[model samples]
Each structure stands twice: as structure tokens, then as C-alpha cells.
Target: MIPYVRDIKFEYGAVDQVSPLIRRVVANNPGPFTYVGTGTYIIGRGEVAVIDPGPDIEEHLEAILKAVEGERVTHIMITHHHIDHSPLAAPLKARTGATIYGCAVTKVVEDDGGVKTEAGYDMGFKPDVSLCDGGEVSGPGWTLESIPTPGHTSNHICFALKEENALFTGDHIMGWSTTVITPPDGDMSDYMDSLDRIRVREFDTLWPTHGPPVREVTPFIDAYIAHRREREAQIEQALAAGPSRIRDMVPVLYAAVDPRLHPAAARSVLGHMIDLVRRGRVLADGAPGPDSEYRLAG
Candidate 1:
């Protein structure tokens, strides 16, 4: 009998086509929040732990408030400093006096708002309580644990709700698309390591940031790992074909990748190329250009 429930949108100000994996009603935006997910995890009528209180949409925030109407919200836990995920933190806190928790990745997340001219993000909200890897905050019906997942973003934190045996994977592992490994902020090497780390953890479900919960955890991990390996091989093969730039491998490396995410695909390619150079498998001199070209190490 939850009354306050806001319908989050999937389509947004930026994206034209909504991917199948994303849940809730949300739009892809030039704004800070692109995809707002559904299924609220309220701890109690008044006391709830909102995993990602997306966008500062009055209606969206109001729905959350309405759902917990007559109840006092105690927590606002952020998985990362992504503008979309953390933008509403401040407003929600001001209204409910809920303690906000997020990793120390805000400055990087706000990146001078250069991309805002392009990505259209409404930069708002900041965490009040900082949560570290393996940190826990317990309240009424839930004990939320932060699991540092560095890949999409170095400070990204995944949450585990002990009572439900559920791991809320925010962009750490998504059902729709392969999470991007954007340089500086996101690290490919760290991503693979985190993937390996999650393999051994016991969890009944994986509640992804963007989509529905994954029922079978291990197979999804296997699929994710295999998918990554396949992409890695593709990168290597693209290199062996001749002197290839990241753009040259774009079509081949991301055959079925969404065109809207071509930039992200480019970012992943850049990260992989850097990793390859480190292992002495490939060679690089500098950023994208003739120097950005790559070939077999030997």
C-alpha cells in the first residue's frame, strides 16, 4: 500500500531511441538526468533509502515523497557522482532532512560542465554523507552496504541490501549496454578487476542502476566477462589488420553499437588501446592522430 509513486521516464531530452534494458519512465537528456529508473526500494512508510533519486524533476521527487507520505525519509544513497544519479540529492535532503551518501567523485562528475553544452545535464545535488567501499549504514528495514565498483567511474559505489540479498549495480553492470570505460574518470583495467571481484560474491539478485534485477547472477557475470573478452579480441584483431586508429576500428569494433553511444565506444577503445600499450602488445606515442595509430608489438 505505497501511495507516493512517481512514474520515471525512459526517453529523454538527448536520446531518440530508448534501449530495451532500461526500466522506469525517463528521457535521455541533455539534462543531468537522462534515464530515471522505476521500482522504489523504500525501507518503511516514512523511513526509506532511495538508491538513486534521479533528476530534480518536481513530479519525480514528489512521487517519491508521496509514496513515503506520512513517513520520514532517512537516507539518500548515491551509487556515483553521475549528474543523473546525484542531481536530486540536495533538493530531496532539503525537503526531507535525509542524510545523503555518495563517494568522493563530485568534482570529476561536474567536469566544469563542458559536456553540459553537449550532454545536457542539470548539475544539482551533492552528498552529505560519504560512503566508502564496504561501508554500511543501517536503518529500519534495510542495511545498505557500499561496494566500491571502479570502472564506469573511479568512485562509483554499488550497494547491497542485506535483507534482500540484492546488489544494486549502478552502471557497474547493466542489462542493456556494456558500461562505458571513459578515460580518466573510468578505467578499463579496474573494470575488469572489479568484474572478477564480483564473480565470487554471493547474491540472489543484481539490481542494476538502469534496468531490472538480474535473476541469475553468475551467468550474467560470465556473459559480461565473455562479452568483454570478445571485445578485447576484436580490438586486437582490428590492430593486426594494419595500422589502425581508434576511429578506423570504430565500425569493426562496435558493429552493433548504438550510434548515439559511438562516443562512448570511442572512449572504451581509447582505454583499451592504452592498456594494450602497457602490456607491450601494441604501441602508441600520443593521443588520437597518426601517433594514435596502433599495430602488433612485434
Candidate 2:
């Protein structure tokens, strides 16, 4: 079953309190991938830390400023370098003098296609502080501990809010839809590993950058894991039938899915095939691409 999202009326630039410590301002950008734009989270009151300032939109900046009126911003923590999540940090930092923090610059593995996917990258973003695993920042009543969970992208990190028993999951875990694992930049191996990493963490609520907050942490993650595994099995079965190209596999595997989403689905299929190749369960005739031929391993 697909994940269900909470009903959130996204009025652009309006700050809504999600919890006592968390207020959200949705950016104006929304689409098939970005369910309701990006949910820019304001953590803590008085002196706050803004997580995922979101897409450098002026109105979003003004909304965030208005949310923390009569207060100061201590730090700006981004979950990852996704465009919809990180661009506004510069302006916010300029206005509030808050230190911006994120994981180090991403080092991606190039696919056989020899083209890197710039799906969610913001080239101009440079975090003031680069966090290591278990790194942390503190404020009046809140503390954010960075957990390196590279899956959605090589540099993706999930921040755990100590005060609220919550985790800012970013694209690693979203309530609206399954994350797009576009290969070369997005790895199935890393994504699965990150999911396993999150499974061991202590977080009651998962506040994703898109969609509403997920309260049932373990079950939701388990479902995500199962979904990927099931998709992998479907791909494996398809390969067992005969030699197939990536395009040929998409309809066979995702026949029930919207044809419009097939391009995205093909990437995820390629990601899974790459993982299977690494595991010696599948054989790729050449660098895996839309036209690459595949068959079951001997």
C-alpha cells in the first residue's frame, strides 16, 4: 500500500504551528515530487533554528521572518542540499546572522550514462558548519543531532530533534510518496542502508520536508523497507522471464502506476538493477542506462 499523507492545506507563506516547538511555512513551489512545496520547519521559539529554509523564495523568507517576530534565529540546519529544501538559508542567514549547517559537499558515483542527475541540488548552498555523524547544535530548549543517512542523495543527513523526539527525515522519508531514487546521484544500496540506520534511531515523529509529519516511525519505516524489497523482487521476476531493457521493465513492473510517472519509475528500476548487479544476482551488458540490456546472473 502507498503511504498516506495528512491533510495539510498549504497556503504559501503562512506559518502554521505543527507542534509547540515546530512551526512550518510551506514554500510556493509544489509539484509531482514536491507534494506541497517544501515544508520549511522553524524549530523552537524565542531563539529559533530554521530547518530547510526552502527554495530561496522571497515570500518564504518573509513568512519565516514573520513567524519568529520579536525573536532571533540562532542556527539554520538543512536536512540535505535539495533545491526545494536548502536555498533560502543564505538570505535567512543574512537577515538573522544564524549560522547555516549541513552535511559536507556531496561526492556522487557517476552512472554508466556518464551524466549526473541534478534533480534536487542547489549549487550555491554552502553550509557554515559541516556536520559529522552524531554532530549536534543546541539552543534554549532544543538540540539537533545530525545523523548521516545517505540514501536519497550521497550527502543526505537526517536531524534528530532531541526535545521533541522527532527526526527531520527530508527526502529520505516522505509521507506523501516514495522518494525518487534516481541512480548515479541516488543509490539503492545507500538508500536501503539509510533506512536501516533510521530503524535503529529513537524518534517518535518523522517530519519530512514534503507532506505532513509521520507519527508512527517504526511501522512507517518498515513499510518503506518492504516496499523497496517488493519492488526488487518484481524486477527480479521480470528479468527471469527474459533479457529486457530498462524501458521494457517499467511497464512490466509498474503497469498499475501512472504512465506519466514511468520515467521516474525507470530510474528506481535502474537503481535496483545496479544493486542486483553488485550482488551478483543480475548481469548488465553495459553501463546501466535506459537502453542497457539486463538478464539474470548465471
Top candidate (TM-score): 2
Candidate 2 residue spans exceeding 4 A from truth: 108-119
Q: Give per-residue CA lDDT, model 2, range 1-298, as digits (tens).
A: 7556767776788889888889999888888668878898888888889989988789889998998999999999987777888888999999999999997556644335433333457766688888846598988899889998887887788899988889998899998888878766678898999999888985899999988988878888889999999988898899888999989889878889888767777878888989888888989897766678999998
Please provide TM-scores, in order, for all candidate models, with all chains considered together. 0.79, 0.93
Against the correct fold, how does model 2 do in TM-score? 0.93
Model 1 misplacement above 4 A = 1-40, 44-46, 106-125, 255-263, 287-291
Residue clash pairs of candidate 2: none
Report lDDT (CA) for all predictions. 0.65, 0.84
Cα displacement (Å) at residue 69, model 2: 1.3
Q: Write the per-residue lDDT of candidate 1 for residues 1-298, one digit (tens) a residue.
A: 1111223343332221122221233323332223344333444333567777765667667766665667787888887766556677788888999898877664344464322212223334356777755689877656878888887777778888787777878778866555667666667788888888777886877766565457778877888888877777888887777887877788776778766656556767877877677668888755433228788789
